[model samples]
Target: KLQMTREEVLHDIAELTSYAKEHYSTVLFSAEDATRSDLNFLIKANQIAVENGATRINIPDTVGTITPNAFGYIVRKNYEALPKNVRIAVHCHNDFGLAVANTIAGFENGASEAQTTIIGLGERAGNASFEETAMSLYALYRIPMNINTRKIFPTAKLIESYCGGKIKIGRLQPLIGQNAFAHESGIHAHGMIKHARVYEPITPELIGIRRSDEVEQIVKQSIKLGKHTGGHALKAKLEDLGIHPTNEQFQKIFNHVKSFGDKGHEVMEEDFLAIVKDVMGELPEEEQYVKIDELTVLTGSVTPTSTVRLKIKNNGDQIEKTASSIGVGPVDASMKAIVKCFEPMSKVKLLEYNIDAITGGTDALGHVSIELMDLETNQIVQSSATHEDIVMSSVLALLKGLNKIMKDKNSKN
Candidate 1:
């Protein structure tokens, strides 16, 4: 979405306004890729748009790179640089999954208007989603957007047809998705069935969506479990099979999930729990367990090497073991080495990997998050970890994340 360097955007106001004057009623001028271009040029462009009678000047953060605070600052700075008569608008992309955050930031900074497609549909990742932005603005910020909340569904369908990706409907999805209204767990469903206000903060009808009868029938079938048996909450309970986790273990898994995000993947449950027990051996007692002994990784190639060594106190005796392996990369190698040493203990699998950088610098540490899906239960397990060396961070982070998933899973069991 670059505005400079492109003749179309640079000359859009001059050529498009004449066409609008003859036939169209309004002209929307967007300076795409505004975030990456020179700010001085943008100010001049904004002046031109207003001079050409453009009703709106749209500034888009196409890369999803700006934080909410930064977004607000950008809008405020740019708007101040522009002629007062030009109406500022915003179009945001969700590449970093922060479109909603950025949109709010724009409003707080100075934007009086926004352009959003239903379900956030657009190219590359998509624009700021209408449902998330509208509801967030209304519910969280108390911004008065006069658009009818009830029109969300039809609007989403209309945009979905023109766009490529599917707009999955559900409650877990925020506003208009299917699960947004259907309660399935025993405690949640019972409370919701009695008084929906107990679980649902907003009415389904408010977003122009209806709870599917089929989902309700499925809940009825789950009556044997009474109410707390389906959905993610129930799935979480099942993950906690029978175990208490140490604070260290918990932090480890939490870090892993964050690391997975860096790599652009969701965390699952099975791989999470399995890796926990895989590394630490029988759950740590109040004071009887040894800490992680040693981990070495050789990375940056099609194949990598990993070595792990651990020492544990058993029956007043110190026992030690080492494992090593070669795999796709350092991460895979390290995981294999750990498994080799801890085999016959339990099975583990990796479901997803995501990663993101904490800061923008060569020295900035990258956070890696992982999701391990439990094959038996079909539940998602999450963990996150970080390091300056992305690969090493990924391996250690995954191990820590794995530990957390297992610790939580065992606790519930």
Candidate 2:
């Protein structure tokens, strides 16, 4: 299947068509890499196959090398030239992530049938994914497909287990990726809980992935919660126990726990929520901290140096601070500098740092959150961020967590 000559391909299709006709009701002749081979040779070969008994002629763009317009044009031309009795089919690969696009084009142009496999599974990249194809046709192209959208995830899970590997859903992978249904903005989350269409194209549940699972799995996963056990995990725990916090309220509590965890300290729920109210109380009136001006970091030696200059205002009081320090690494040094300037009067100490990337490749962003313990009272603080720069994210997250912790503390009085 990997490599075959024109003669061999023709002979194989002829044999297959004969066998299919005798054994089954109808047959389709699929010439692999039909678009790449000499068109004249393929046309003659297909003609012979159809003459013998092939009910359909399939053209495959094996490498996703053709644009949709070209693909459609070719399929339409081929179908029109071929005998009326023979239907046309299109098979596409996703080498350039345009498999869906090409498939749509083929269908629109002339192909009545699509030869598709799940998740575009094939060699040297993959084939056109059945779920993505179906979703795109139904959702984007307004084409009708018989597939039930809800069956996608279960089908994928089964295939993945049988294949003995994981399906790496790219952050941009439509419909099924972890980030696909994620909403980071508070408004989006609130809207999703009320009605998913506010942010998601289709309710994740429509794909057999329930909202609870999506929330508890993907949302909590993003926050370093769930099985990975970070801030969202605490949030999950709190929610399960019927302890609900408003968006701003939870932000403060979560930041409290993340700060401590980032410093390497694991905490119990009693310790986790004790400082929640205190942190929530310190949040800025508009629910935003000083916008990060910039940070310069130098590390990879005995000691690391990090300098952060921030532009901030409390009420109407504007202030700026530039500080530097040498510590374990850029993240550590950055946090140290931020804590000194941003929360100089606070006594929170980072006890743990945990960072994980949801996906792979050089472009993936690290989702970081941490735990901290106030040196003065042992109260915990935590916070998290998704960023391409882990060190920078870590510093900003720490400051955010500290600010929340102080806010909640001040509010208690």
Best by lDDT: 2
Model 2 residue 326 CA deviation (Å) reads 18
Report, for all candidates in order, the number of backbone clashes.
72, 43
Instruction: Please give the CA lDDT of all the candidate structures.
Output: 0.63, 0.68
Error of 2 at 191 (Å): 5.1
TM-score of each: 0.46, 0.55
lDDT of 2 by residue, 1-413 (tens): 54987677778778878878887767878777777777778788888788778888889997778888888887877877798777998988888877878888888987877878876678667878888778777787787767788889888767767876656545656676666765544444545444546666766777777664345544433223212244434555567556777777676666655554455443333344434433443445654545568788887755788888876555555678787777777787888877766665556778888887534545444567788777766788877654446885587567677666655655564
lDDT of 1: 0.63
For model 1, what is the error of residue 35's alpha carbon versus the real structure, in angstroms, after optimal superposition? Answer: 1.1
Give per-residue CA lDDT, model 1, range 160-275, as digits (tens).
66645555443456676644665444577556545556766776667776543333432332222211233333333223445444656654544543454345442233334433
RMSD to true structure for each model, in Å: 15.7, 10.1
